[model samples]
Target: MNREKLPVLLDNEIIEIRPDQSLLTERYTDFGINFINNLEKDQPFFFYLAHSMPHVPIFASENFKGKSKANVYGDVIEEIDFNVGRLVKTLKEKGVFNNTLIIYTSDNGPWLNFGSHAGSSGELRGGKFDVFEGGYRVPCVILGLM
Candidate 1:
């Protein structure tokens, strides 16, 4: 039997920030907007905004709540879209829109069983934990730098 020593687990107080419970999207949007607004044209900067949304237990801010016809997932998506639009506007206002590179992508397939809370993988098969194409065949949208 091949016995491997397991790494010692550190005692850490993990703070749970539930994607659907906290203002995660709003906070990330603020961070990106602030960074873009304060960036200097004389120096190059790399801003990466990662948002956790449209996921399970998804929670949209009060402004976006019940604003969509789809449901929580749709509302969350709309919130993200609004934030992205704001980011683009900021970039354009800063005159760095043409130089910035924005890449939007997802980590994996959706949990179809999550119903309204889950995103669609379209015609792709398998999702989330499955080993199918849908599991890893996520969407990627690249803009700005051509």
Candidate 2:
């Protein structure tokens, strides 16, 4: 199989030619954390963090790689979870945790063709390109802003 080449872009410009994809989750989280940290306490801001992992050619940082029993796929998810925790901690430290609104969801189901490298849609039939419920069904979580 041919490995996909992914590039890192900033402001619609390529910033790095060969960024370590494994650290992308942490990097995205850090960007969000820093943005929040530098904001005025009373100022309203919006931060959007979109991760690229858990997709084809998945990867996990050294801290998370090989740390899960569910193989590389699990490692990638664990890394995402870790970064999300860090983001939440930063929000709480900034005293905006209670007022912040967090919405988390996947764009689509996993690619079942990748075998263990892809996520499971549980008992849902089909995935990704298929027209079954598994292809469109996804988990969504909304928190805070109460």
How high is the CA lDDT of each candidate model? 0.79, 0.88
Per-residue error at 133 for model 2, in Å? Answer: 1.0
Clashing pairs in 2: none
Q: Write the per-residue lDDT of candidate 1 for residues 1-146, one digit (tens) a residue.
A: 21242121214542432233447787778878998888766579987776768767688999898888888888999999998999899989989988878899988999889988988788999999989988899989999668
Query: Which one wins on TM-score?
Result: 2
Pairs with backbone N, CA or C atoms under 3 Å apart (clashes), candidate 1: 20-57, 20-59
Where model 1 places Cα greater than 4 Å from the true spot, the runs are 1-22
